[model samples]
Each structure stands twice: as C-alpha cells, then as structure tokens.
Target: MSDYCRICLEEDALDNLLIPCNCKGTQKFTHKSCLHRWQETTLNNYLCCPERYDLEQVLTCRLCKTKYNSTSANFSWRLLYTSSPLLALARKHTCVLTFGISSFMCFSFWLFFPILFNVAIFSYVVFWKKGYRFKFIGTNEGIRLRIYKIGLKVNELKSGTILKATNMIRDGMFKNSKILIVKNKEEGAVGFIFNKFIDETENIRCGGPVNQSSVHVLHDNPDVEGCEKITDGIYIGGKLIPRPENTICAIIKGYSAWDSLQLDGEVRSGLWQIDNTECACLW
Candidate 1:
C-alpha cells in the first residue's frame, strides 16, 4: 500500500509527508502545512489548559496526541510567517501617526517634540514585544545554545563546551560595545560580548557569527578593562559584577543562514521565564 497524508488523503510526497506523531501505518503521515492548519483550527478556542496551550499544543498531533520531533525550527518559521505581516502593518501605522502629529504641531515644536519622541519610542517597544524577542541562557562557564523559541529545551547546547570565537577587535573602535569576560573553575573562560549599544526603548540589532558559535571581544569598556574573573562572577575592569539570584539574561539570536535579511528568518531564543538562577541553564 502506498503511504498518503491521513489529513488530506493525498499521496505522500517527500517534501510534505511528515510523521509528526507516533502513529502507525495509514495514520502516520500528514503534510506539515496541513498539520499546522488543523492545529490552529482545533486549538484556536482552547486556551484554558496551561499545558496544552503553549507551543507544544501547536506541534502536537491532534489525532495521535504525540509531539513532533525536530519541528522547532519549522514551527517558529511558520509562526513568524503567520504573525509578522500584521506587526509590520501596525508598526507602519504607528510611525505615520507619530510623524504626522509631530509635523502638524511644528508651531509648538519645543513643547511637543519630547512627547512625540517618547510616543515613538513607546510604539517601537510595542513592536518589539509583540513581534519577537530573543532569549539568552547564560551559565557560569559561558553562554549556551541560542534557540529560536522557548519550547525546544532538549536541543540546547550543554555547558563547558567552547563556542568558536572570531572577528577580534578593539572596543574603542565601536562606540557601543558592552564586553564582559566569564570564567568558571570547570568551564574555563568565555566572553559575553555585545557589539551594539543597547537602547532599551528601541529594537536591538545583534551582530555576531552566523550559525557558528563565536564570541567577539571588545577591549574598551572601562568596566571590562581588567578582564578578570571574580570569586562567583566576572569582574568588569575592577568592579565585581555578581550574578543575580534568579535572573536569566535575554539575548538576540540572529536569523538562520538561509533566511538572513528576511523577516521570515528572524526569531528569538531562550526561556521566557527563569525560576532557578543556580542552574544557569535556561532549559
């Protein structure tokens, strides 16, 4: 018997035939797109169950009730595809309104300029929050596995593994570099490098290696001059920067190599919440 998609009753094509759940024989195969459509339709009204309402609800096979493996990347891609255009439209409207009102109030420029600026900044924050935000998991050793979303905890990189480092440069060359060196007795050393000056109110552009794990070093921050590891945390220059009790640092994980420069490729990685800071690993 030939395999076919159980959902659409179509012949299984290599590209579309995906075994999302652990069902057998005729019930085994379904188109990825079809599965997503079915999930959205079925789960749209059911958000009461906390366990089934998250991303797992999206990836779980409704028929077999099993989760899909290796679907995080694709799930996230689909999510961006489905949600980004709406966000872009909202952002456009916000920009037009802010600029239009500001222009109309040119007579009272001094009085309204700051207010308009604040409003514009607030709009950007809304855009960032609703669109997508990156997550970072930091450990005593270094940073680990930058994922695209919050659900895939199994694929995160383990601690003590060294990420490849490249593109070394002086911090003075870059105006907004926040650099910190991390060292652990067991994990050796790794540097947490931020290439751009983080503007809290605006969307942040994170620059670094593509796909490959690498840390860029900046030698300019007065707090990062000494580059020493204190007892429990890192020393920025001479000041001891202690680790927070239950804080998980959020990071901007860039797009996939294939999807770079496209809205479809941009996604955030890391846990949305942190309960145990001692573990340091978000997963």
Candidate 2:
C-alpha cells in the first residue's frame, strides 16, 4: 500500500499516482495537490525575469511574476519622469485643436474670403513646426498626433527625429550609432558615438561650436573623467549640437533606456530588491 515519489524520495500511500510532465532536463513527483502547486510555482518563477540581456545574473534570489498594478500602488507620479516630452506635447496640441478650433472657425465663417489669406498665413506659421515632430515619431502605435486647421482634420504627426550629418567622426567601425543629448546646450550638451566593434573599443566625440572652433564640452564639465576627446565637438556626455529638433530634447542609448524602464516598473510595484539578482541597481 505504498509507492515511491521522486520529489520526496520516499514511499507513499497506494492511492497516490506518479505522473511525468514534459519539463525538460528536470524531474519531480508529488501528491495530486502538491504536483499542481509545483507546476504553478515553476511556471511563475520562470516568467519573472526581465527580457533584456544587459542585466547581470543574480544568485540566491527569486523574482515573483506578479501583475504590476500602477493604480493600486499610488505611483502615478512615476509618469511625470518617464513620459517623453514629445508625447505630452502631442496630447496637448490635439486638445487645443479640437476645442479651440470651433470658436476660431465660427467667428471667421462670415468674414469669409476677405480674411482667408491672413488666416491661412497664420495657420501655416503656427503648425509648420509639427512636420518636424512627424519625423522622429514615425508610426508609433502607442500614441498618435492629430493635425488640424480651422476645425478640419489634416494628417497625423508621428514621433522621432532624424540624426543629422555632423562633423563628428567615430573611430573603428560603427553599428547602431546614435546622437545623444547628454547635456543642455546652454549649460552644454554631450553626444556619444558608441562603437559596437568586435574589440568593444568606444570612440568618444565631444565638443560644441564656440566662435569658429568646436570646443570639447565633456572635458570642461568635470563630471566625465578618463574619456579622451578624439576630435573637436566630441566627448562622453557632452551637449548635443543644434539640440534635439522639435520636442526631442535628448536621446540616450535605447537599450539603456529600456533597462531603466524595467527597473522603474519593479520599483513602482515594490517588487525590486536592493540585491535582486536580476536588477543591477543602476538606478
């Protein structure tokens, strides 16, 4: 009236039945209730880790894969820091065009063609800057910008800005290269040219145009150290020249940003451990 269970490594009552599941490279056996609990625990534990590979592995720690509830935690303030400026502006502009346009249009309906020229000129000047917005955003699904004039819908403005050609040059081969606004142009700006070369050799480009010469801004900042300025207007964490056009005030390494986001989620939910194996605590 007894059977052997692989989990407990002991004999149990005859009513117990051992079943094998398709878990690869691992084995376990348990009572009916225990088996179900084991499966749930195994599956939930596997789902908790962040997908980004940049995080270093941690030992002797466990992450619980629980649904993060932003509302329940009173963490609404987190939105202010994470939401991009371009996204906020897009929302504001759409509201103004929808409610504000009705008044402007009805008042002008009778004035008709006489004021049409002036109105057209005014509308063009006001909305022309929107085109620059569509460049960077380029078809993002999470948000959409509505374009309108005189209560008539026009087009959709997309997100993102194009990295323009600059005098900056990167040493070694370039892959996934980007322009980053590491600092303020007035206070100073910083741009980084990440080199994904096999040797992992990163070339630093830091400088800003002062008078006729491009000065190395990172060198002057005193915050960044041990980074060599390869050329003028080249330094680690220097101000971006011309600034991020439109609403893009800055760009960091996209991967790094996503990592920060994951950490933010964990912190908001109170799931982050000071020594969580998966979290490097870069935040």
Candidate 3:
C-alpha cells in the first residue's frame, strides 16, 4: 500500500513519513519536518492571539483530537527545536499555563506544606536538643488507661464478685443485669443475673443466655446442707436438708458463662462496671 503525507499531500518520500496520531487511512502518515513546521505555525498563532486559539490545539491534531506524539520520530533535532519554542511560550504565559491564580496558590500550598512541616519538626528537636521523642500517647493507651484504673480490672474478678452491666450493652439480653459470680476460674466462669426474675416461676430468676437450659441455685442460708459459700452472703449448689429460719434463696434457670479469658476481655472492654461500690441491692 502507498502512504501519502497529510501535510505535503505527496505520494513520494513515503520512507520519511511517520504515523503520530489516532488518525486513520491517508491522514495517518506525516513527515517529521512537515509535522514540526505545522506545530510551529500553530504555536505562533497561539502566541499572536492566545484568545483566538488554545495551546492544546497547538500540541494536538484537529482531525483526531488527540495530542501529537512528542517522541523523536527519526533521531533528528527537529523534536527538540519544536519543544524549545513551546517551553518558551509556557514560560511567557506562566499564569495562563496554571489555569489561574487560585488554582496556582492551591498547588503551591500542597506542594510545600509537607516540606515545611518536616523542617519545623526537625528545628524543634535541634533547638531543644531532645533528640527524637515521638510520643503520640503514654504507654497505658491514654484515655482507656485513665478510665479502667478507676474500676475493678478484669484480672480482679473472683467468686462472689458482683458485676453490673454498663449502658454499652444496650441491645443485648444482659443489658442492665447485676450478675453475681457463681464459679470463676481459669477453666471458665459462670454467673447468674441476680436482678432478672422469671415470669414462669414465682421466685426463680433468669440467669442469662449462655447456659440457658441449665439450672442453678443461690441462697443466703448456710443451714441448707451441702451448700457452698460463694461470697459474703451468697451460696450455691446446696440442698435444703434443714431450711434456716431466715433464708433468701432463688432457683435460677439458665446461666451466663464465658470461655477462658472471655470474661476478662468483656470486663476490660467497658461492658461491665466494677467501680460501683454502693451497698447494692440484689434480687
């Protein structure tokens, strides 16, 4: 197939032609010299009356509407000569090249602010001779450390210890529960909701969801044989061989249990409050 130059419109000298843009068919071929001269003319027109033409039109093709390839077509200085004038034009109209003043200011600020920040940081260290001390917060995790220090920690949980649910457990079944620790150890822990009474049984309490089907008992009477004391006034897993004269007892269906370390995690996460030291009432 014979190639024709879009610029010179000649059939001969096809070997000197280069395809530079997305233009197809006959318009695809362009001579290196011819293309450079055409770009120079378009750039001159922009320089003469920039309002009459856009710089993009100088660097791009009108037909294909694509930016002209700037790579050296043939190892000639023609590309260098063509770009020198364009760079001069860019310098002459520096404000216009940036699209306006506000845009230029924004670009400048973002480009230099990070550098200025690093310089200021280094200056502070050099002036004070503190070397490098990067302390975002203290070792105890700042706010959390302050908060948990005022309460009983998860590691402090033990048998008969009382834990009240915080407002953070708003959507769960354990919300607003005052739990009395029944069995607590490394194996796991079991507690019952002391404040939630069951509707089905007159005095039986609803423990919680973890071991929902299991039943346990808590009582204040040591007279009941086989009763094991849990805390100051609490007992578990005993029989009423001889009921005491004054006994406070509850049969709880279901119990709340945690796997090893699970209860500790919950307590630390602010789900339960141990800081409350008021002589609290228990169901």
lDDT of each: 0.44, 0.33, 0.72
> What's the residue-level lDDT of 230 in candidate 1?
28
lDDT (Cα, tens digit) per residue for candidate 1, span 33-112: 77767766545644445345443455566567776666622566356446756755765699887888888788588788
> Which of candidates 1 and 3 is the stronger one according to lDDT?
3
Clash count list over all predictions: 4, 21, 0
Between candidates 2 and 3, the one scoring higher on TM-score is 3
Q: How close is candidate 1 to the true structure, as a TM-score?
A: 0.24
Q: Write the per-residue lDDT of candidate 2 for residues 1-283, one digit (tens) a residue.
A: 5666555556677467444332222233335445445444443453354243111111111222232233211132234224435544755698777777887887688678658878887777766543211122223354455342121111110011112222232332222243232332222223332222222223223212112123232232222444444333333334445433331111223221211122223223333222212111110
Off by over 4 Å in 1: 13-16, 46-55, 71-73, 77-283
Q: Candidate 3 on 132-242: residue-level lDDT in tens?
A: 222232333343221111222366688877899999889777888888877777777888887888864567788987556788877787767888888777788776646
Candidate number that wins on lDDT, 1 or 2: 1
Compared with the true structure, the alpha-carbon lDDT of candidate 2 equals 0.33
| Top lDDT prediction, candidate number | 3
Give the clashing pairs for model 3.
none
lDDT of 2 at 222: 26
